[model samples]
Target: MEDEIITDGKYRYIEIGEGKPIIILHGLMGGLSNFQGVTHFFPTKGYQVLVPELPIYDMPMLKTTVKNFAKFLEEFIAHKGLKDVILLGNSLGGHIGLLHTKLFPEKIKALVITGSSGLYESAMGDGYPKRGDYEFIKKKAQDVFYDPKVATKEIVDEVFATVNDRMKLVKTLAIAKSAIRHNMAKDLPNMQTPTCIIWGKQDNVTPPNVAEEFHELLPDSELFWIDKCGHAPMMEHPEQFNQILDAWLVKRGF
Candidate 1:
């Protein structure tokens, strides 16, 4: 098969399917291809999927800030002339989704944020330091797993590989520096579109209470907590994720 491309001078996207657009955003260490498994299900469900690697991940973007990154998305969508896309984002992507909706509510149909990052103040937890390095992320990722025994060597290696990836780490640090300074709690109440939030009940990365707090703030939002899963609930529990996604889609007339 030949590779297809969606380019607009400065950026490009690889997309698939045909129907109402469902744009998926990957997290800090993720790329557009990360959505392949999840997007596979959407195509069958009749969703024209567009997974754009955010500017920080997209090779062309250099020295990007949160504001410019948001603009990059707007430009990408405008370049493609897409409208009424359902925005589905995970982790860092979720922060972008929220920012995008705030900037152009008319362009998106709905929002689904899973294990989202970038909305809380940086603070020390009960027994942990406020800021930890790779060790912290690794430990936290492990704790998110429902069964600690299931946090296999493979998973640990993958997580370590992700943080240690050169480009991925740069993106992570740069975005951390310029992202709307977290605290989206104040903005949630203003969101007009219906939103569905999914989180792993065992997610130490972003606790269930945090997801619930988002739901409470968003006037029109629902929460689904997948059991026996962790930070990456979509991957850890795809079946439950799909069921919740479809039900939310049906409920919202998407």
Candidate 2:
């Protein structure tokens, strides 16, 4: 069965211009609105952008898992009749994109991952302090930003406004914990799709070293580094991010 499309609902998105399809997934604690400016930027550059909010939220009925998240994206593609989709994601969303590519490699035309997670330096013996379970959940939200000022109460409040269930935070933290423990890097080498990995040179959350490892494992992938940015470069440096993305698409003729 193809994916069903629902409109006039809370799940926000815009279909603009018209060319090859490009779907974007947001990181943890983000809604589709996290990409407000992006929809226009891509469409005018000559592509379609589908920015869908993940189905799971505060609803006790909703189950958000890597497996199910991929299923939702599959449905989304089918419902919209999108072909030649260039899938992209950041952080936890990037992990989801990798999983989706593994599941439906043929549906994806290409992949772009930014400061993605799932590679932690646990076994490296870097002598870094290991975060306890409680500490991980309560991990310094401030540290994810290149500038700690971005962690201001207003920004935190805006993010929390979209997070329906506070308990979901526990689940997300645990999911991230498992990614580093279980490892998602194994799926990339088998991937034949054109892949690009973008990183913030100053990213502290995932660290620049994680990008190096991803580049090492995914030998067929392209890596780009952006300076004067942090974890959420898309939001922090929208122009530069969009420019590079546009260039990547141009190379592919999307």
Candidate 3:
């Protein structure tokens, strides 16, 4: 995935297949490779999949807000000359997609969010007192998934590195605060974009109830659940996640 990324001016992304675009938004600590299942599966199924590298840490401290990330997405969409595209996001990425849709509804065709943090604040970047402790960091990473094994050594190392970095750590905390400040509960009902909410039944990060609340708040939303899955349904249960999203897109004629 790293080798496949195309660097065009200020935007760096992965574009595959050729059809209706499905722009993927990676979460705060998530990388483009996290959506390997999506990038590979969707392209073969007649949809162009794109995973943009969000400037989560590159922005100035004051600009490190979810709203600015939404604006950046709009710029990326316009740069690519895309229209009526589907936006699929997870965690912080999901929050950005929601804000983007609310701000720029004309171009989005549909939205898919999993383990998103709009109503309920996530525990990301919390309890970092033991940032220097490898075992502690490893355990924290494992907590994101129902199956602790999903948090591989590489994943743990990546998270450890991010939290240990001074700049990235500060920006991460800033984004977390921005997520809380920009809660979408009051704005969900007014935004009528068709949404597909696929959640893990055992997600401990955002929890299961958040999905139900999203379904209740969003005017046009359908929720699906994957058993034994955690915050990252796509990573933990990619097959189920893809299947549910595929069926929803077909049913809604997207």
C-alpha lDDT score of every prediction, in listed order: 0.73, 0.68, 0.91
Candidate 3 residue lDDT tens string, 135-162? 9888888988999998988898899999
- Candidate 2, residues 1-254: lDDT per residue as tens digits? 22233463445455556887888888775555555566668888778777777754432423446666777788778778777889888877787788888898778988888877666522111322233332322234445567666555655564454333456555655454545654667876777778788888988777889888888777568788888777776766677888888887788666
Candidate 3 wrong stretches, greater than 4 Å: 1-3
- List of clashing residue pairs for candidate 1: none
Look at candidate 3 and tell me the lDDT of residue 180. 94
Candidate 2: residue 148 Cα off by (Å): 3.8
- Model 2 lDDT, residue 85, Cα: 85
RMSD of each: 4.3, 5.9, 1.2
Q: Which candidate is the best by lDDT?
A: 3
lDDT of 1 by residue, 1-254 (tens): 33365775776677888998988877665545545567778878888888776767554435555656667778878888999889888877788888888888999899999888756522122443213255665575457556665555665556577566776656656676666464577788899888999998877777778898888888999998898887667766777888899889987799
> Candidate 2 lDDT (Cα, whole model)?
0.68
Quote each prediction's TM-score.
0.80, 0.80, 0.97
Question: What is the number of backbone collisions in each predicted candidate, taken in the order shown?
Answer: 0, 0, 0
Better of 2 and 3 by TM-score: 3
Please list the residue runs of candidate 1 whose C-alpha ends up more than 4 Å from where it truly belongs after superposition: 1-9, 57-63, 121-171
